[model samples]
Target: MASVLRRKAADRGKSLLDMILKERKFARSIVVLVFKATRLRLSRTSHKPGSVVLISAKICIKSNSFTRLVEAEAMVYVSRSTSIPVPRVYSAFEYKQRVYIVMERIHGQPLSVDWVQRSSTSKAKILEQLRLVADEMRKIEVPEDAGVSDICGGPIYDPRLPGRSHWGPFPSISAFHRQLRNGIVPDDIRDPESIPQDLRELFLFHQQLWGKPVFTHGDLSSLNILAKGDEVVGILDWETAAWMPCYWEYTAARDANPQNLFWREEVDKFLTPNPQAWEAEAIRKKYFGDL
Candidate 1:
């Protein structure tokens, strides 16, 4: 029954892709291979455009608010600065109030699916590679001429509400902290007033604990990381990527929930452990009350 439903969904995605191609006058030989709600739709085309191209499209409502152009631009920004692999953008545009992104379909499995089985030595090697990736990130200084829209927060693709479009491509770490304190999530926040007074202040106090802004993947859950053997082949889903406080990357990786025992024990191997984990937990506590 589940497989039947999945097949139906895939067919619908293929139909949607066909419509997109027809409307845009894009090549028609493309075939969709996968689909997911709020994630991405995967397809392949090998026609007049050039060589074989594997395209990943984010056209779902969960993705549309942020805009595909921002994700494409973010991927390009990181690809130019680091040896880390990312999908190349083919095109990004909007139709019917939906943002569509077509990019390289990376040919690797998500690290989350396989991390549990690897030996400790293999895990260490992978972590070393991740460390090198982080080192490359540190060297990427944000542009001096960048504006508020281009500052450290979610990409300012839409001028609507700076916080609404994305988690933040915020003006500063302090600005992000203010957003958290104000309970400005794009979706919903449960009873913001129920959060304790001191905890709210604690959240604000942490904002002053600053580091120079640096480039970050923003959300580096194992799902975003792709691997083949012990090496990470690509990192996907840059919709949340930003230039934020230096400690932001470490905080994100360490706070990621390890879904299994092996992953639980091995979580710290992915990035250098730091104080952001505790701070992040404190932030969560303020909003969600005891997790």
Candidate 2:
């Protein structure tokens, strides 16, 4: 049954025991597990099929590492509020070589950019909904279950640097810059180094100083955030979740457009995570009328 289910999931671009789901010596799964000696199993599959019931160890064992992280995270936030939008988490347990996190399988539409494009006239309404989620999220407290050290991890630049990696691009900021300059990403704005000192500083500022540090969906890309008629129903893909500054995922990530352009429909000067901002001059200027 397990093998059959795994095969079925794979056909749908979803897989239990996915390639990304690393396995252990016992052929079981592992979670934030430090030592590989333990594995987890779901104790019970509640009949009603709500998130609280443990589905099945065999099934849970098939989850990927990223799923484990999300379940563990859900365990932390579930206590806060059921009203707010988020997947409900039940457990994070380890047994032999496996780790399992039980969660309420959310029932809602997944986020897609199609709606954002379709709702241009009502863009502000959509943004407002996003802003509300952000506001509610800012209120949630990090759970003691997941340790801070485990969540934030290490700093990228200068082992000597403080806190964490630069929010945008890191290790080699220049690589991202080169991509931007060479038109790696379409509709990119900003003029590399030639940018004014103030704007340059602002570009750098966004990297470091956007949002309040909280648990963030690090992979809050278009494909990850779900929606149903403009209402953000669920946030998928917890593999990239982390405790970090706020807007990096929420504000900056929510939209792929020149944010300044949305309001007043102006594209004055923009900045992205790339090393040099001036990569795609033609397209960038076409929107702004001038780079």
Candidate 3:
């Protein structure tokens, strides 16, 4: 009976949210009002600029230019397919060119909050749990012919990239690499002598590194990981999650912000290290500056 009542309540909430979404002006007004009135803002770091306001004790809404509806979709996909703990999305939509995601407001604090003070054993336990999360995400089956893309096979967004814009759902890893090289196909360069020595080396290195597509949480900073008593209760910020090359997860985690220096050093403890991929990424970034 309790389960049935909960389902009915959820359905009613969805219906009301849909009605509000239909009225764009009213929805925008409500978002602004709630954002200003709310005492708590869930988004803690400037690592990703966005506003996540707690509308109620149990619910929150994330709205920003950087947020995308696909982030909500990615959370839904992960929640259904894996044991990884993610926020439960209620509704996601775009209004006035800005995206808003309404979701469950997890009560835990970010892992970075007390990380420096935690004992070695507690830290080890948390890292072990993260390893399990990494394993579970890898077990998700990729569709045949799947390329690097957002959860729904749409273009992906990564702020750390050169333009901080949405890029292709490339047909293959090689095609993706070609895009990275600004459409200069390595094979098309018949005269390697014409290219700079470093550029030539990078192209050749990328060509030899072929990796299978796997589900990736592209931003795995400690700030995005929520913990309750050393147990990771939720992994927030799914905007950068996607189907990416096998090396992506490791490199992304390792290449975290400067503030996350300690976490960056500890990433390999939970995630499988791909030293070659890290070197390749460093080479690419050396030539093509990131945001």
Candidate 2 on 71-183: residue-level lDDT in tens? 46543553364345655443455554444554445544544446435655454555566566555555667544332222434221111112332323222333323322332
Candidate 1: clashing pairs of residues: 152-169, 152-170, 153-168, 153-169, 153-170, 154-168, 154-169
Q: Give the TM-score of candidate 1.
A: 0.64
Candidate 2: 10-residue stretch with minimal lDDT: 263-272
Residue-level lDDT of model 3, residues 1-291, one tens digit each, is 655544443334444444554453335544444553342222344433347865555667888778899999999999999989999887777777877787889989887778899999999999999999999999998888788888789998888778757888888888888788778765787886787776776787778756668989899999899999988999999999888888888988888787787898889999998787787777788777653
Candidate 2, TM-score vs. the true structure? Answer: 0.43
Better of 2 and 3 by TM-score: 3
* Stretches > 4 Å off in candidate 2: 1-62, 65-67, 78-82, 95-98, 113-125, 141-212, 250-291
Model 3 ranges with Cα > 4 A deviation = 1-33, 36-50, 187-201, 209-211
Angstrom error at residue 106, model 2: 2.1
Kindly list the per-residue Cα lDDT of model 1 for residues 177-257, writing each as its tens digit: 555456553225388787566565565555566755666776667777788888889887776566665665665555555
Total clashing residue pairs per candidate? 7, 21, 0
Better of 1 and 3 by lDDT: 3
